[model samples]
Target: MDVTVAIDCMGGDHGAVVTVPATRGFLRSHPRAKAVLVGRPEALEQAKGEFGDEFGDRLNFQVAAEVVDMDESPVSAMKNKKDSSMRVAIELVKSGRADAAVSAGNTGALMAISRFVLKMLPDIDRPAIASALPTMKGRSYVLDLGANVDCSAAHLLQFGVMGAMLVAAIEHTDRPTVGLLNIGEEAIKGNEVVKQAGELLRASGLNFVGNVEGDDIYKGASDVVVCDGFVGNVALKTSEGLAQMLASFLREEFGRGLLSKCAALVALPVLKRFKRRVDHRIYNGAVLLGLRGVVVKSHGSADAFAFEQAIYRAAEAASNQLIERIGERMAAMDGVQQA
Candidate 1:
């Protein structure tokens, strides 16, 4: 199926410098996909020049009047920057011109504008940021990364429902297991809210696998992990920091002396494999689940390669009909409730 993605060319730290090249690279691999580049006409023209006719008609452009600054508050940006690249790109999806939208912009601004433009899915109170994380058993999806800092037990239950449906659509899993992030494995261990969320998950007809701790995330105890935005953001940032620190330490140790350098040369192949396994760029896209339309958020500081991964992820989700699948799952749940 042909998938169309709206690109916010002026959203990230590097703006068109990164997004344009990333879109080109993504199109090279995904021939069935098309991109609508949204940004200033001058910048988009420059990007078009760089690609020449290689992209053919697969790549197009739209002019956006303004740009949203990284430090701007979400509410202020939403109110003041109506024609901003980020908002314009998302608007393409709302207008049925794009199957999905990808932006490496301010997370808050993206979320706020997206919610304002696309609204929420039926039976979905709020949307959550859901992303994949590397795990020993491959990878797992985690939700509420930073969208809703204060989520209710009911909200968490909705996240589990949306996340499981997402995994089922993208990974083709019949019944992906969902785990509630908690202090302990026992059902009664967490705070009242978490305990209540657990109770709901256990009875919600989902593949509830009980509560899992921090260690269980990388251990791959479940296919989906659920938590409020605050905890999820902390966990995500901490993992990123640890990965960077480990890489720095390894570099320092490898250059310690001639002997260490020689050992590093001998182990270069193994080290490369290890780096690929843990590379965050391979998982650059975070889906804003429960939105009426498809929206993807790329890491703001991502480079061309990393941003390309985000585009690839957006195309996959669109082609797989992720939004429709989530609706069907929720509809089934409603049927059970009405029974």
Candidate 2:
């Protein structure tokens, strides 16, 4: 197998019911990929019986006694739940048994256990969450999504580099453009940290775009967008909420009357096309950047199809050598700074 991923099977609301089927789908779609289903044996027994003969050695299992709760505290999960599915999955990455790890569990616990197990990449003081978000042009990868609430100019610069390298390694784009999330396109628009980060990005040798307003993210103003976690998290949540609200409005309007029902039937194809374009499930996995290993977080409430998308993302990053690429980019930037 070109890529081996460790998946936390006893994670998310549906647990094995969703993750196991998703693993089956992933293995079917990715012939060159292998997956280790990590969870309690009882939860994975049926999966083992079904896929064991089908996949042979391509699919394996590692027993994890405990499961991290969706609301569990990061500290408690880190210190207490040593054998939790989330922790065991990450451990596989650290031991080189898996190229990457994926989990649809507590985001906080996953981040804590991941940092504790895999550690941060060299010269990377902190880890930032990065993910691909759909845009008008195509998609743009944004970083620092709810990882660090407060960030310095240096931290923002690091985020830009990591985000760019992620796009480069996974998307095969060299020198992907980076944009600082700001209030305006002008240089003097945002806070000092953002202003300094823009200057750093401009001089850091990456294809740095000047500044991008919030709406510019959907405009695909740049290939990668960098912002502090506070802003990034707020922006992400707001977008999600807005999408849900618009969808609800559409449903309500369509069901209002008989004439509306007829209109909805006539417009059904166009609505489906729009829904497919904006479906969050298509972009289900979030990359935890700056870690020494590849780790992806799937939405905890994801269904089988959505979870499979996360597996595909993990396999893609592993096969593409995302961690090594990020390290190389960081080292290159350090050399420039020193010279």
Candidate 3:
């Protein structure tokens, strides 16, 4: 596997402190993997200082000269900050200097810069950010996670196909089930767009599971859930918030009394595992699907471990040649012929 990852050293909240160590950790585990750290030379030097020779050989540095601010408008950043870290890292992938690009920066800006720098896959109309959600059974993927807010039925159907391909490749789920996120599971429930998308998916010759209600997400009824960015983003955020609230509530209950503390002690290991399973940080990376190259987005607040997972995810995506697979699938589908 050509596991080379380009990381924006200036992308996250903690900047180089997080990126540098995470790169070191990733290289430590993957001796053959290469990491190109992109950002201001001075900051990257200081951050890269922590690793010394361990990452010195496998690591290369690119001076981005600028950064795309988290609050800046996505289009403005793309138009104005041509030399930003986000743009530079994406350029590496486009130029074949790196196999994948990983960033823990502004989601909107990253998407914008990636679209501008690396371009989209041939048959893709718009790129979607696909994230894996760990379910009771295992892991499932949700697509258009805040990438394209308003989507047509065709867009949602395409998302399902791409998402199914992704999970099948990475998660080893052959014939991964696809479902359209809707208000209800019934065939005639949602508005016209969803109804049309559902019909398209069911007839697309893929493993379509019909419609899936929001509440059924964690139940793992489907392996790939497709929706417009607006609905998918709301569901993602709601799940994260609810998980936090429940963990806090459980801890509070454990602190209530001596008997409660004793019970909590007995269940502490199980609770810890549950907390780890539900933490958003544990599932820190999202793939910018439909891009010409692999681009993984890490949460802005991610720490070293989260960054490590992002690196691993990027490596897996690149090794799998996700974009190439998508192109092949599109070529085979007469309706969505490769662009």
Could you say which candidate leads in TM-score? 2
Listed in order, each prediction's TM-score against the native is: 0.96, 0.97, 0.94
The 10-residue segment of model 1 with minimum total lDDT is 330-339
Ranking by lDDT: 1, 2, 3
- Residue 2 lDDT in candidate 2: 92
Q: lDDT of each structure?
A: 0.91, 0.91, 0.85
- C-alpha lDDT of candidate 2 relative to the true structure: 0.91
Ten-residue region with minimum lDDT total, candidate 2: 330-339
Model 1, range 8-92, lDDT digits (tens) per residue?
Answer: 9998889988998899889999888899999988998898899899978888899999999998999999989999999999999
TM-score of 1: 0.96
Instruction: Write down the TM-score for model 2.
Output: 0.97
